[model samples]
Target: MVGTALGLSLVLLFLSVPVFLVFGLGSGLVAIFGLNLPWSTLIQVSFGAVTKHVLLAIPLFIFAGLIMLRAGVARRLVALAMAMVGHWPGGLGVAMVLTMGFFAAFCGSILAAITAVGSIMLPEMKKSGYPPAFSVVLAASAGLLEALIPPSNAAIIFSSLTNVPVSQTFSAGILPGLVLMVLLIVVVMIRGRAFSRNERAGWGARLVAVRRAVPSLLTPVIILGGIYAGLLTPSESAAVAVVWAAFVGFFIHRELTFEGVWSALKATAVTTTVIFSIIAMATFLAVVLTYTQAPQHLTAYLLQYGIGPITFLIMVGVICLVLGTFIEIVPVFYLTVPIFMGIALTMDVSMLHLYVVFTAFAGIGLLTPPVCVGIYTAASVANISADKAFPQVPLFVGVGVIYGVLMIFTPWLAEWLPSALH
Candidate 1:
């Protein structure tokens, strides 16, 4: 039954069927034939996956992202970031990275960050003499911060699956996010030298930009600070983010309208549905695989073969990177987390650390070839093919790999903040 389900999923995936359906139908087949389960079981499992309180944060964060995008928040963020970094060699690239990091706090959705910031920054970068492909690639790679920063959907999902506190997961991501941010800045400084032509803004201009952006900049402060202050749960913080985004966009920024509000909600609904569907279907697959004791068998095999924790972790990172190129990170998490969780537990690895490291690696894969969603989204914003942005992927990916290695060996990189806060 396991072999049959795996075979069917591969064929459907190769044939270009939607990923949700491939997992759903393949697992449904296993439950029906192998377990002799009734159809209602599948329905129940699929529905139950999205019924969690933590999952509620996903849609709320997504809604906030759209609201900020339409509210001209990205423009203010770019201006603020430029005022701080735009005079250096590759300053626009630095500003792009910083802007994406700031936006990632509120958006949490990577592709949305790429689209919002890319639309605003790409044109400006082009006028500053930056290469079009390079600009797109930088934007896409920077967007990976969306998964690592606070209020991240990936962190929320990781917390849900592992039973860790969402706030701690959010905290766990801070160092890694900062590391990646600095690494990206260095890369931009080196590669962006040829096109670095922007003049430094005066202190007066910098202060003005900062003043204009203060309201938009309060987003992460509100969300993370509320969590740290014990005033709100992660989901509650997400709800507040939505309300704050709406208020800022509509009343303060004065760029959002009733129609714009409706549009953001509609788009959020569609994206939420797609993500929830994939999670539901992947849950069904997890259920079927558990019933077959597949994870148990694999865990025993690995243990018997004397696979050490370091070796196992490295292998898991490789699998995450490879699978992530072909699948969305959420589904990839569902598909592999079960099999690896037992191994992780048996080896005495911290589940929180494992999740953070693996999620970061998977995010890096999103900027890679064949199915680089971030690259494609940002490239489209600039009216270019993904291939044009392909050349810039290697350097960013190298930095990602190096960071992954550091996380693996340094463990504290993922554990310190959460522990310190505790």
Candidate 2:
């Protein structure tokens, strides 16, 4: 029965069915036919799943992210990053990493960062003699930080599902994001030695860049800072960020137009709908799994096989990586969480730790092949074939996997900040 239901889900996914249907129909059928649940069970669980307050943060963050991207927030921040690092050997390489990290601080989506920031950086990277594959790979991989940083919708969703505080979930990602940043910096520095370095910007230019960026730079601080300080909830912080982003767009930067806000709203609506549906359906499936005692059985199976926390986490990485190739990032996240969370409890694994690692692996999914949306987006922005970019991905993805294992060994890398903040 388990195998059949899993097969149904995979088949529906392969047919390009909507994820809501994949979760709803595939899991629903399993519940009804295999588990003897009534059809009404689906409606009850799906509707309940979407009602959480933390879910409110998602659409708000998405809207603010879109507005900031169009308002040239990435442009100003990229300038500041280049000014800070452009004189160093392989500075553009380092600059790209910094730009992605800085962009991540404002924008919360990896695909958006890849598209918006990559367009700005990839061409310069090519002009500066960086390899095309290297350029796309860097943009796609560093783009992961967008989802890892504060104001991350991914973190917001995880917090909602797991009952963790949103601020703590956001804080948990800080060190791992920084550690990955340093690793990329080192790799780029060595390989970047072969690429041409830009002439250092004059102090006057640096000052101007900093002056222009200061308003945009305050964005992450205002959004995440308020949350950490306990002055605002995640939803409230998102609301404030949206207003601040629009203010910067309309008055400060003057690049954002009325049409941009409208488009951002429409896009946010569509994205929010899709994400909410996935969450709803995933919740339905989790209830179904519980009814069938699947979690207990799976836990017993793992223990019977002598699996421990380390092995279980490694298995999870493998599972997420494989599913990510076929499923979009959000659906992959919700689809796996129910199953993983259950078994993780039995292993004495930290649920918070499992979630942070899960989110990190989702980033790698964007870099993984066949469905590497992150790479394709970066490649398109770079005007290179994704096939050309594929060869370069393994190294970055390997580093990411290493970071996942590192997080496993050093759970404190994710847990410490969240705990301290509490």
Candidate 3:
């Protein structure tokens, strides 16, 4: 029954069926054959999935991201990053990485990060003589950082699915996120030298740019700082981010208008609806998997084959990497984390450690090919071919693998900050 469901799901996915439909089709098959379960349970599970309190973070975070993008925060951030790094070898590339990191901290969605930052930076990089392919690659690869930062919808969804503490999941992501950013910065420094033709500006101009961006930078501080300080939960932080972004983008910056707000709100509604639908469908499928004891059966088979914890971890990573290349991060989190959490617990892995491993692996999916949502987004914004942006996949994947290994071996990298806070 497990084999039948898995095979059918993969076939559906390959045939370009939407994820929710694929999940529903697979679950329906399992319900009819594997277990004489009532179909109403599927409806109940789908509805219950969105009723999760923690799941509130998803829409709020998405709204915050859309608001910020519509409000012109990305432009301010890019200007500040360029002012700071534009004189360095590969300064534009450095600016791209820096801006993406900043945006990720607040937005927490790769598509948002790529679209917002890419629209602003791609043109500037091109104007500065950066190769269009390099610009597209930088934007697409940096989008992966959105998954590793706090307030990330992926982290929220993963937490909801696995019943892991969302705060710890958020904290566990910090170091790994910074590490990935640093690795990307290094890559840009190496390849971006030829594009850094601007003269170094004096301290006065740099300071001015910093001052100009201070308000924009404060969005992340307000969002993450409020969460870390225990003054707010992720949902509250996301709401605060939306309010703050509105304040900064409208009255303070005078950039956002009524029409702008409406547009952002509409975009948020569409995105949230799609994400929720996917979550609901994935939940129904998870119910089927649980009812059939497929996870237990699979785990037992792996153990029977002498697969150790490390080998199992490697296999999980490989599977996520493959799936991620073709799927968006949130749905992947919804579908896999529940099944994998059971296996991880059976292996006695720490929940914190497992969260890190799963998230890092899932983050890889955002940059891989076939689906590569981030790459497609960046490519579209930069007016470059997705094929042109493909080379950066290996580079970003290398960074992701390094981060994943760090989380696997030095679980402390993910656990320490959360532990200290507790």
Scored by TM-score, the top model is 1
Off by over 4 Å in 2: none
lDDT digits (tens) for residues 132-176 of candidate 1: 988888888898788888878888887777788898889988888
Angstrom error of the Cα, residue 315, model 2: value is 1.8
Clash counts per candidate, in order, are: 0, 0, 1
lDDT: which candidate is best?
1
Pairs of residues clashing in candidate 1? none
- Descending-lDDT candidate ranking: 1, 2, 3
Q: Candidate 2, residues 1-422: lDDT per residue as tens digits?
A: 65667789889988988778888788788888888887687778777779888888888888898999989888898899999899787798788898888877767667877887888888998998999999898888897787777778778877776787888888888888888898889888988888888888999999999999998889999998898888999899989999999999999999999999998889888878878888888775777777877778888999999999999998888787788777776887777777778788888888778877887777688788878888889889999899998889889988888877787788888888888888
If both were scored by lDDT, which would come out higher, candidate 1 or candidate 2?
1
**TM per prediction:** 0.97, 0.96, 0.94
What C-alpha lDDT do the candidate models reach, one value each? 0.87, 0.84, 0.79
Error of 3 at 65 (Å): 1.9
Q: After superposition on all CA atoms, what RMSD does each candidate show versus the true structure? A: 1.3, 1.6, 1.8
**Model 3 RMSD, rounded to 1 decimal:** 1.8
Model 2 CA lDDT for position 209: 97
